[model samples]
Target: MLIFRRAKVEDFEKIKQIIKDCGLCDCDLERWLNNFMVAEEDGNVIGTGGIENYGEYGILCSVAVLPDFRNHGIGDGLVRSLINLADRMGIKTLFLFTDKAVNFFERVGFRKTNRSEIQENCPESKQLSSCPLSFIPMRLNINEFFENIKCK
Candidate 1:
């Protein structure tokens, strides 16, 4: 069985490897390690994701699942868990930069947004600062997401 839980210090290398395999930036990941969530199966870390808190806003980052773990709902579970965490943390909006998986995020209710909007709103977000121009910026409003879920 697969389970999602807060990432532990010992899971760093596994998380890093998964992120690297997915071609995501791993710089400064350790700084926000405490906020990360991991998907573990039979005591092995198969996926990881996290958010960078910026007061009322946050940047979802590092969402990745191992090749063998893809399409098993691990990535979706990790994202949902992180969204729940963001809601609990009083984050009004969540943003992310992704070169891939835009469709996946869209299915989860994130909408594409202009990169300049992210820069203006998330000036202090380290993830945004280091994100490449090619990556698409997306955002989800926490309250709106809950409302949409209820409607469904």
Candidate 2:
């Protein structure tokens, strides 16, 4: 069985390994320390993801999963937990910059959002620092986000 829970400081190493394994992004350890979720099955962290609050919004980041565990729904569970956390925190919008998971986010109900819209939010700036300017930015409206969560 898979379990979803708020990531703690102790989960750091496992989370990083998952990120590195997925080869999605070169993120700092300290950043993951502040925001993330973990998916465990039989005590092994098979998947991980995070939502960095951007003041009025949140940026979904650091999503990764063990290769062998893919297609088993762990990634979707992680994303749903992050969305629920954001909604509870009162964030009305969520954003992300991804290299290859755009279709995954779209399947979860996110749409391509212009960088111009993200630039207006300061919290999003920190998440964007060091990210390639060419990365596509996607966004989800909170109301729609909750709907997607329920549907899932």
Candidate 3:
């Protein structure tokens, strides 16, 4: 059984291990722990994802799943959950900087966005501020997202 829940303080070490093992997140472990939602299976955390607010938009980051647990729908489910969070918060758009998983995110309704477009909406996203700047920015426009969902 898979469970999705807001991450608690106690989940920090487990979350950090996932990030370090995945070699994705560079932020301090505490920062990620404060910003993510966790996925659990039989009480053991198996996956995680979350959004960090950046003015009018948010940054979708720290999404990772254990290697043994990949290829299941957990990551997709976590993304969908954060997308719903962005919608509920009245955020018009959400973006992420990724070197891989573009296809996965695209399949879930995000599209590759130009740097200028991303900076215009979420200039504060770390990808715009300090990251190597090589990461591709991807965005989901909420109105179009809902329209597409309805059409499906």
Best by lDDT: 1
**Residue-by-residue lDDT tens digits, candidate 2, 5-63:** 88888888888788887876644557645667889899888888887776668788888
Question: How accurate locally, in lDDT, is each candidate?
Answer: 0.89, 0.80, 0.79
Better of 2 and 3 by lDDT: 2
Model 2 lDDT at residue 5: 86
Which RMSD does model 2 reach against the true structure?
2.1
Cα displacement (Å) at residue 110, model 2: 0.2
Residue 102 miss distance in model 3 (angstroms): 1.1
- CA deviation > 4 Å runs, candidate 2: 26-34, 148-152
lDDT of each residue in 1-152, candidate 1, tens digit only? 88999999999998999989988887478788988999999999999999988878888999988898899888988999999999998999999999878999999999999877777877877777888889899999999888888432
Tell me how candidate 2 scores on lDDT. Answer: 0.80
**Cα distance off (Å), candidate 1, residue 43:** 0.3
Each prediction's TM-score against the native?
0.94, 0.88, 0.87
Residue 22 miss distance in model 3 (angstroms):
0.7
Tell how far residue 16 is off in model 3, in angstroms: 1.4
How does candidate 3 fare on TM-score? 0.87
State each candidate's clash count.
0, 0, 0
In candidate 1, where is summed lDDT lowest over 10 consecutive residues?
143-152
Reference-based lDDT, residue 30, model 2 = 72
Please report, as a residue range, the 10-residue window in candidate 3 with the lowest summed lDDT. Answer: 26-35
